[model samples]
Target chain A: MTIKQIERLRKGAITLLMLAISILFLLPFLWMLSASFKIEADVFTYPIQWIPAKWHIIENYKEVWIGKFPFYKYYWNTVKVTVLTTVTSAFVSALAAYGFSKINFAASKYLFIIVLATYMIPHQAILVPQFILYRQIGFFDSHLGLILLSSFSVLGTFMLRQFFMGVHNEYIESAKIDGAGHWRIFWQIAFPLVRPAVATYAILRFIWTWNDYQNPLIFLRTDKLYTIQLAMQKFTTINGEFYSLIMAAAVSAILPLLIVFIIGQKSVIEGIALGGVKG
Target chain B: MQKLETAAEAPKAKHISKRSSLQKKETIAGLLFVGPMLIGVTVLTFIPIIATFLLSLADWNFIAGFKDIKWVGFDNYERLLQDDGFMKSLKNNAYFLLTVPIYLAISMLLAILIDKHVYMKSYFKVAYFMPYISSIVAVAIVWQVLFHPSAGPVNQLLISFGIDNPPKWIADPKYALPSLMMISIWISIGFNLIVYIAGLQSIPKDLYEAADIDGANAWHKFKSITFPQLSSTSFFLLVTGIISTFKIFDLIAILTKGGPISSTSMLVWHLYDTAFVNLKIGYASSMAVILFACVMLITVLQWLGQKKWVNY
Candidate 1:
């Protein structure tokens, strides 16, 4: 074979190999998706039926979505908390990033270092005292408390500051020279330049909040206010024997995240790329 | 007198006042912008940390209210050494650290393979990254079903291959931690893979050309060029990955609840149980202090260690 032909053949073989690996990697999810459409009796059938002979998709999903402790309530709660948290975190982080990167304040260096230091202390270390403090302050067992817990992130501020630094000094300087206040320059010139970075942080914050089981698990006590993760756990426990229903609920819980991933795949890849080079 | 002074010092005084006012505006704006985060971090994180430390030295049942708190000094820390459950969890967390290097190696290999030769990179990236972004509750529940002892796909495949008694993964005490580790590896490899691919792409290609000109083989090129060039990314992944393993709670909570004889119990899960389930706030705070200390120690060690091997 010619050298070009040999190289082409090798690449083709690797592609085929990766295709096989992808299938293997995705088997569990594909199984979960397949099982959710199967009847209870067929869920564990021998020889592992990859497809349901008779589809029970509507019935299974309906039971999960509208049953006692309906999932829609939890979904609504999750959406509210995740959306509010993301918006607040992104804006607050961006504002802070702009301040630290662009504004020449005397205490900015020390303040930024302090913020970075806080990221080192894991949230798990403070849960005990936070629980007590929240209880004492009457913020316990509320969605508002849960939202406030993660709305201000040191990591978010730090990540956004890196991008804001890439915005040139000339833009802010010209805006200042135009008799614009710091606020006007921030809103018009600085923030727009780093909007993509802010959006990236917002997207990450959304995913983190949506998938958060720890905060809601601890802070929110009312069954009526449980988020999707909490609700999914409760549903699974109550219906442990019904794998079909559990599979359906599991699929419903992650469907939105999958949709988000699909729509924001470009930004998500960019976020990881940015994170890759961080020291 | 005012008119005479205005005429004499108008330009120089006006410039000084304008510059100071602008500096004042900038400082005010900076404070206003950073105020929310600063206050939130202080009240929410810093105060709580201090409270955790003070509470660790005192015995206080959260239900009993403030006046009942009893200061016991180093007693709680002393008890940690003798507590079997705490010891097991400590050991388990150390064991979980094994997943970091394992995933890092696997991801590095996959990253190299796909970065150079693959078609449809986006499809593969998304497919692999799916598990990383999916809700851990969903991921855990799905894996729970997948690891079912008798009827699950995994054991079914094992049976087909003539293994008489496949291990009961989550249920079996001996296999539970390993099973959790396997799931963790699966969930995390995609993230590591994505990051590694980004690092691989950033490597300068002329180094490879030089190596090829010198008659270097693939392994030699990889060891000298690819590995060293990618060391910083590797170190970043290593530190973040190890830190995350310390935070493994959702999977254990869903799958084992640190059960099967506390075989899969981890530090965070144990702290959660002690604080929330048992309401031993003081004891849990002591554990939290230890947890904080360990993370600080690991991070400091890694920071110092990076100077030797992690290339900037």
Candidate 2:
């Protein structure tokens, strides 16, 4: 064969290999999505029936939504916590980032390093003390406590700081010459310029807070306060023997996050890329 | 305003104005903006960490009053040194660290292969990343079912292939930790792949063209060009991956609860069990401090290692 033909053949082989690899990666999710709609008896059928003999999608979803498991309550709780944490974290981190980036002060560098050092402390190390302290303050088992704890992310602070540093000094100087105070300059100039970064951090913080299980598990004890993950765990116990129902509940719990990710993936990927670069 | 003018008259307004109100105002705004975070770090994080250190030195149980507290300076650390469970956890964590690098390499390979193919990139990317986005609780539960010895799909598949007896995965002390490792590697490959793909895409096409012009084969080009260019991404993945894997707890909690015979208990999982289940808060705090020190030491060593190889 000619060189060009050989090259085409090689490319075809590589594509075929990639296609096989992709199929392997995708198989479990396909099985999960398919099994969610299957009858309980059909869940473990041999050779793995790709399609369910019977579709129980409606029944499964109905049970998941309004059954003994208060799945909807969990969804709402998760939504509230996630939204509050994301907005507050983004706002606070951005404001702080502007301060660190533009404002000159004594011991600023030392203070920034101290903030960065906080990132290195493992969550496990702080759990006992934090739990004890929160209990003493009567904040334990309260949504406000969880929200407050989630809002103070060192990663968000560092990410926003990097973005704020990238902002041009000229804009702040121009705003300064106009007799605009520091807050005015921050709001009018820096905020708009770094809007993309702010949005990126917000979406990421939302996903992280939404997916976090340990904090919610430890802090939120009441059934009413359960988040989606905690709710999913509760679903398992309530319907311990019903594999199909549990799968359905799991699907419902993940669906919102999947939707959010699909919608905001571009910014999320960009933010991760930027974060990796800084690291 | 007249009083301010009179005060300014006593001292030269120029001298007073030498330090720009702009500077003072900016300083105040900076403090105001960072104020909440500073307070949080001091009260919620920094103070708690110091408190943990102190708590580790005392034996205090919540059920018992503070009046009954006992000072156990170095006793917890001594027990930790002699405790078989703690030693087992440390060994398991080391095994976890060893296994993680292999998984990360596999992920990098998968990412590079997918990146080389021009089509179906996003399809593979999303598929690989699905596990990363899924809850660890869900992942662990699903894997637990899959690994069931009697009727689970994995064993059933093995039986269909003519194997007589499949190992009871999470139940058997021998197979439990390895089983956990396998599932972790499977779930984590996707996340690292995403990072690798991002790194691969950033490389200029012209570098490959130059290699091709020099009569370099695919393997040679990959070794000299692709791998070198990807070193920074690789280092980032290695450090973060090790850190994350070492601190793993949720999967162990959901699946094995530190196990059939404590085989699957990682350091963090052990720490959790000690603190929450056993209520050995002081001992658990010491374990946590040890874990923290281990992580810090590893990170520093990795940084030093990177100085020899990592370009930037």
Candidate 2 recovers what fraction of true contacts? Answer: 0.50
C-alpha DockQ of every model: 0.73, 0.55
Give a tens-digit lDDT track for model 2, residues A94-174. 877887888888757788889889888878888888988888898889888999887777788888888889989988888
* Candidate 1 per-residue C-alpha lDDT over B164-196 given as tens digits, one digit per residue, 9 for 90 to 100: 999999999999999999999999888899899
Candidate 1: Cα lDDT at B206? 97
TM-score of each: 0.97, 0.94
* Reference-based lDDT, each prediction: 0.89, 0.82
Candidate 2's error at A10, in angstroms?
3.1
Which CAPRI category fits model 1? medium
Say what the RMSD of model 1 is: 2.3
Worst 10 residues of 2 chain A by lDDT: A270-279
